[model samples]
Target: MTTLQNEPAACAHAELAQLRIRVIALENLVISLLADTSERQLAIARDMATYISPRPGFTPHRPTVHAAAQIIHLVGRARHFRPMAPSRRSR
Candidate 1:
């Protein structure tokens, strides 16, 4: 007679256990998803860094001081040869 009266309480306990199992499964799924997202974000960051970074073996072109001076001299010579306009007449 007591077992028959406790039968409804036992069913309620079983339902509660099932709900707990489902919640644990959902938590596991969320953790896995977060880990995957973190990995993908790291990969994308590395790819973007590769695109923006200069190559290891690249050597930039730098003009020597002598070459720069030569260019300046040439420009000066051209300026010296340019025709000068007549001086402005005073009013």
Candidate 2:
């Protein structure tokens, strides 16, 4: 009886875990694509993150706010993959 009651909860937990894995995979793909894109496109993506960010003192849904922050953080990570600029001394 207790096992039957816990079964649904276990299923739900498993589904949630799968969803999290998918989200992480998607984030990594986006980071890779962004890293390969032009600087102008990357800047546009950064602007989009800023655009979606919640304003001060405004109550936005938690997930929405989190997504915005994730986008910005992903962009930062993508930036790290970009090639380093040539030093002035090398020019």
Candidate 3:
């Protein structure tokens, strides 16, 4: 009876120890994967700076067909047709 009791405890201890080792190994693997990802991000950022142009004027709108449509909409919204003057009030 004593041997049987000790057998179960030993089995539980061994199983717990194995689980701990596996958890530690998995933690190390995740850390290594994160480090690799960081290195990759740095490489991609360098590539972007090397390839992308940086000489456009400081305009809020992108130089696209969408910007043209937006400009037309703005002009249509203005009540007066003056380029740099406001309309006089008819009191």
Best candidate per lDDT, number? 2
**Candidate 1, residues 1-91: lDDT per residue as tens digits?**
6998999999999999999999778655544443444445544534554454445687523443344443334344344344444674354
lDDT of 3 by residue, 1-91 (tens): 6998899899999999999999778655544443444445545534543344333573433454454443333333331332332454554
Please say which candidate is ahead in lDDT: 1 or 3. Answer: 1
In the range 1-91, model 2's lDDT, one tens digit per residue, is: 6999999999999999999999989989998998888989988887887788788888887888788888889988998787667772355
Please identify which of the two predictions, 1 or 3, would achieve the higher TM-score against the true structure.
3
TM-score for each predicted model, relative to the true structure: 0.38, 0.77, 0.40
Sorting all predicted structures by lDDT, with the top scorer first, yields 2, 1, 3
Model 3's alpha-carbon lDDT is 0.51
In candidate 3 the C-alpha lDDT for residue 54 amounts to 36
Error of 1 at 23 (Å): 0.6
Comparing 1 and 2 on lDDT, the stronger one: 2
Cα error, candidate 3, residue 3 (Å): 1.0
